[model samples]
Target chain A: MDALTPHLPVLLVLTPLFGGLLAALMPRRGPAPWIWSALVTGFEVLLGLSMVKLVRQSPQETITYFIGWWPAEYGIAYEIDALNAYVILVVALLAFVSTIYAKSSVEDEIPKDRHNFFYSIWLLAISGMVGICATADTFNIYVLLEISSLTVYTLIAMGKYRDRRALTASLKYLILGSIGATFILLGIGYLLMLTGTLNMADMHEQLMLMKAEGDLAGNRTILVGFTFITVGLGLKMAMWPLHLWLPNAYTFAPSAVSALVASTATKVGVYMAFRFIFTLFGSVYDSSATLALMAFCGTLGIIVSSIRAAQATNVKKILAYSSVGQLGYIVVGFSMANESGVAASVIHILNHAVTKGAMFMACGAVVLRMGNADLKSFYGLGRRMPATMAAFTIGGLGLIGMPLTSGFISKFYLISGALHDGKWWLAMVVLAGSLISIIYVWRVLEVIYFKKPEKRAPVEEAPFTMLIAMWILASASVILGVDAELTGRLAEFAARVLIGGAT
Target chain B: MEGLGLFNYWIAVAIMMVGFYGVIAKRNLVKQAISLGLFQTGVFLFYITMSVYRAPDGTPGRAPVWEAILDGFTKDPGPYDNPLPHVLMLTAIVVGVSTLSVALAIIMNIKRLYGTVEADEISEIEEAIEHREEMMSR
Candidate 1:
C-alpha cells in the first residue's frame, strides 16, 4: 500500500484516458461503450476518493507524483491537495452519473453508429478535466485543456442529427476556444521564459524570491503574462460578456452532452480561475484592482444572466443562462479575498456542480420525452412526468436558493461573506440575484405544474437509468444542504491552502 | 544594422493582426481557418524570435546542440541560446495543426449539410430553422 500510494495521481488521470482509448477500440458489436465508460468512471471515482482520503490523512496534505521517476524540480508533477482533491471528486462523480444517464439518452439524440465514438469522446473529455484538476505543471494544464476542448467540439457537433445549429455552435466554440487556448499558451510561454520553470510551485518560489529583491512587482512581462492568462481563461469560463457562445453551445448540443459540459467544463474553468488567481499569481496580483474587477464582473454577470434566463423561451437556454448567473455568485465570493469569501467560492464550486448537474440532467430527460425543450412544451410536465419534474423542481428551487438546498447554503455563505467584508451592497446583490433566479425558476415551475398538458402522447417517466442519474445529483443537493459540514471543512482547507497558508 | 532589432517583432505583429482580421472579417469558413493558421504561425514566429541569442562579442550564436554546449563550457560558457522555447513551440505547432484540421473538418460537415461555407448564409438558414422549430413547438 505504501509503495502504491504515490502512483495515485497518475492513476487518477490515466484511468479514464486509457479507458477511453480502450472503449473506442472495443468491437462495435460488443457491449455498448457507455458500459465501458461507466465502469471506467466508477473506477476513477474510487481513485479520486482514495486520493482525497490520502491527502487529508497525510501529514503534508498533498500527494506529489512525478512522472517517469523524474524529480519535482524539473519534470512534470501532479500535486493533489485539498483544493483540487475536492474538485477531482466532483468531476469523477458527475462523469459517472452522466455516463449512466447517457446510456439511453445518447441513443436517440445522436446517430446510432456514433454511440461508441461519442462515449469515447465523453470519456476523453472527463479525463481531460480530471487531468486539469490533478496536475501541478502549468504546461500539463494547457495540454489537458486542449484535449478536453477538442473532444468537446466533436461531442457538440455530434448533435447535428437533432439540430444543424450544432454545427455552427461547434464551429463558433472551436474558433473562440482555440483563440482562448492560444492566449493561454502565450501566457505560459511568457512565464516559462521569465522564470525558466514550468512547475507552478517552483515558479511561485522564484517569484517570491524576486519580490524580496524588489525585482518583481510592476514587471511588465509578468503583468502581460497574467493578463493573457486571465483573458484566455475568462473567455473559457464565459465570464459575463464573454459568455455569448455558451447559450447556443448548450442549447443545441445533445442533452447528455449539455449536462456533462455544463456541469464540469465551465466548472473546471472556474477551478482554473481560482487556481490562477489564488495559487499562482494570487499574491503578486492580489491588488484592490483585481478584486474590484472580479466583484464588478460577478455583479454584472448575475444580473445579466438572470434577466436573460427569465426571458429565454427554451428550457435548455433558461438553464444555461441560470448557469452563467450561478457562476457569477461564485466569482463574487472568491473575489472578496477573505477566508469566508474563499470558503464560499469553494463551497459553491461543488454545490453548484451538484445542483446544475441535476437541473440539466432533468432538462435532458424532458427533451428526450417531448422532442422539444421550449417552455411552451413544458406545460403540465409536472403531471406528465411526475418523477422527472419533481427532480427538476427540487433542482429549480435549489437554483432559487430555497432553504435546505445546496444553492441556499452556498448563497448564504456568499452573502454573509460580502456583508462581513463591509460590502453590504454586494450582499444585497446576492439577494437580488437569487430573487431574479426565483423569477426564472418560477417560470419553469408554473409552466410545469399549472398549465395543462399540451402533448397527447402516452405518459411515461424517463428510463430508470436516466432518472437514477438525475436523482443521485438531486438528492446530493439535499444532502449537501442538510449536512454541509464535510463540504465546509473541505472547502475551508482548500481555501487556506490557496490563501498561502498550510501549504 | 541593429540586427533586425524591432523589425522581427513588427512583422509578427502584422501577421497576427492579419489573421485576426481574416478570422473576424472574412465570411468564408476555409478562409477563417487559414487565417487562424496564420495567427498560429505568427505566434510560432514570436516564439522562435524570442529564443534568438547573441554571444558576448555581439555576434549571433550557433545552433544549441551538444556540440555548442561543449564549446561554450570549454570557453567561457558563451551565449548558447536557450533551447526550451524551440522545444515548446514544436509541441504548440502540432496542437495548432490538429486544431486547424478539426476546424476544417467541421467546416466541411457544415458545407455538406447546408451546401454553403459562408457564415452569413449558414446563420440565415439556421435562423430560419430555429424560427420554424419554435413555431412548431408552440
Candidate 2:
C-alpha cells in the first residue's frame, strides 16, 4: 500500500483504460469481456477506497500529484481533495456494481457480436469520468470529457439493434454535446488568455490576485468566460432548460448504458460545476446573482420535470424525467451557496446515484423479463417480480424523500440550508417538489401492485446477478439513510474543504 | 490600427457564428455535422491567433524555438509566440475530428433506419410510429 499510494489517482484512471483496449482484443464471444470489465472495475473500487484513505490521512485533506514529477507551472496535476475523492469513490462503486448488472442485461438486450465493443466502450467511458474527477488541468478536462462523450455516443448508438430511435438520439446528443464542449474550450481559452495558466489552482490564484488588484469586476473577458463555462457545464449536467437531448438519449439507450450514464455522467457534470464555480472562480468573483439564477432554474426544473415524469407512460422514460427533477434538487442545494447547501448537494450526488442506479437496474431487469417497460406492461408486476418491485419500491420511496431513505437526508439539509439563508419560500419549494415527486412514484407503484393484468403469463424474478447488484445499491441507499453519520460527516468535511478553498 | 490588427478574431467569430447558424437551421444531418466541423475550426483559428505574441514595440514575435542555449546567451533572443495554445489546439483538432466522425456515423445509421436524413421528415415518421404504438397499446 505504501508503494502504491503515490500512484493511486493515475491507476484509478489507467486500469480501466488499458483494460478496455485489451478487452476489445479478446475473442469475440463468451463471458470473457464481462469478466474483464468486472475485474477492472473491481480493482478500481479498491483504488478508489485507497484514494479516499490516502486523502483522509493527509493533514490538509488534499493530495496533489504532478504527473511525471513536473512542476506545477507546466505539467498537469491530479489533485484529490476530500470532495472529489468522495465523488470518485461513488463513481467507482457504481461502475463496479453496474458492470456486474450489465452481464445478463447486455446479453439479453444487445447482440452477441457487439458485446466486446460494448464492454470496451463502457470501460473507456468510466475512465473518462474518473479522469475528469481526478485531473486539475482545465484543458485536460475538455479532452477527458470528449473521450467519455464520444464513447457514450457510440454506446447509445449501439442500441439501434433494439430501437432505431437510439441512432437519432445519439446524433442529437452528439451535436448538442459537441456544442457544449466547444463552449467550454472557448471559455478555457479566454481564461487562459487572461491568467496564462491551465492549472486550476494556479488559475484560481491568478484570479484572486487580479481581484486583489481590483481588476476583476466589470472585466468583460472574465465575465464572458464565466458565462460560457456555466452554460457549458449546465448543458452537460442537464440543468433544466438545456436538457432537451437527455430524455430521448436516456429513453432509447440500452438498459445497462442508461444505468451507467444515469448514475455517473450528470453527477460528474455537477462535480465539474463545483470545481469551476467554487474552487476555480472562488469568492474572488461575486456569484450571488448566478447562484440565484441557478436556484430559480433548479426549482423550475423540479416542478416541471416531476409533472412530466408523472405523465410518461414508459417506466424508463418516467425514471429519466425523475432524474432531471432529482438533478434540480442537487443544483438547488449548491446554489444556496452555504456550507449546508453545498454539503447537501454533495450528499445528494451519492444518494441519487445509489437510488437511481438501483431503480434503473431494476427497470432493466423488468425489460429483460418482459419485452417492454411501459406502464401497461407493469400491471401486477409486484406479485410476478416480487423482489424486483420491492427493490424498485424502496428506490421510489428514496426519491420521494420518505424517512429512513437517503433522499430524506439530503432534502432535509437542503431545506435547512435554505432556512439558514433565510429563504423560507425556497424551503417550501423543496417540500413542494417532494410532494410532486410522490405523484410520479405512486403512479409507478400503483401500476406495479394494484392494476391487474388481463392475461396471465408465467414470470420469474430477475436473474440472481442483477438482483444482487440492485439490492446492493438499494440497501446502500437505505443504510446511508438509516446511518447518515459516515456520509454526513464526510460530506460536511468536503463542503468545508470546498468553501475554504473558495474564500 | 488596433482594430485592423485584431481582424483575425473578427473573422474567427464570424465563421463560428455561421457554423452555429448552420447547425441550427440546416435540416440535413450531414450538413449539420459538417457545420460542427466548421465551428470547431473557427475555435482552432481563434486559439492560433491568440498564440501570436506582439512585443511592446509592436514587432511580431518569432516562433517558439530553442535558440538562446545554442548562442550561449550572446544575443538577446526576440520575444517568441506563446506555444501552449498551439499545442492545446492540436489536441482540440484531433478531438474535433473524432467528434465529426462519430456524428457522421450516427447520421449514416439514421439514414439507413429512416430512409431520409432530413430532420423534419424523420420526426414525422417517428410521430407516426408513436401514434401507431399508442393505438395498439389502447
Number of the top candidate by DockQ?
2
Best by lDDT: 2
Tens digit per residue, CA lDDT, model 1, A170-215? 9999988988888888788788767888898888777778878888
Model 2: chain B TM-score relative to the native chain B:
0.91
TM-score, every prediction: 0.96, 0.98
Clashing pairs in 2: none
Which portions of model 2 miss their true places by more than 4 Å?
B66-76
Pairs in steric clash, model 1: none
Candidate 2 achieves a global lDDT of 0.92
> Alpha-carbon error at B6 in model 1, in Å?
3.4
Per-residue lDDT of candidate 1, residues B13-131 (tens digit) = 78888998898899999999999988878888877777888876887765667765667657554466778678878888888988999899999999999999999999899889878
Off by over 4 Å in 1: A1-3, A501-503, B1-4, B66-78, B134-138
RMSD after CA superposition, every candidate: 2.2, 1.3
| C-alpha DockQ of every model | 0.61, 0.84
- Chain B vs. true chain B: TM-score per candidate: 0.88, 0.91
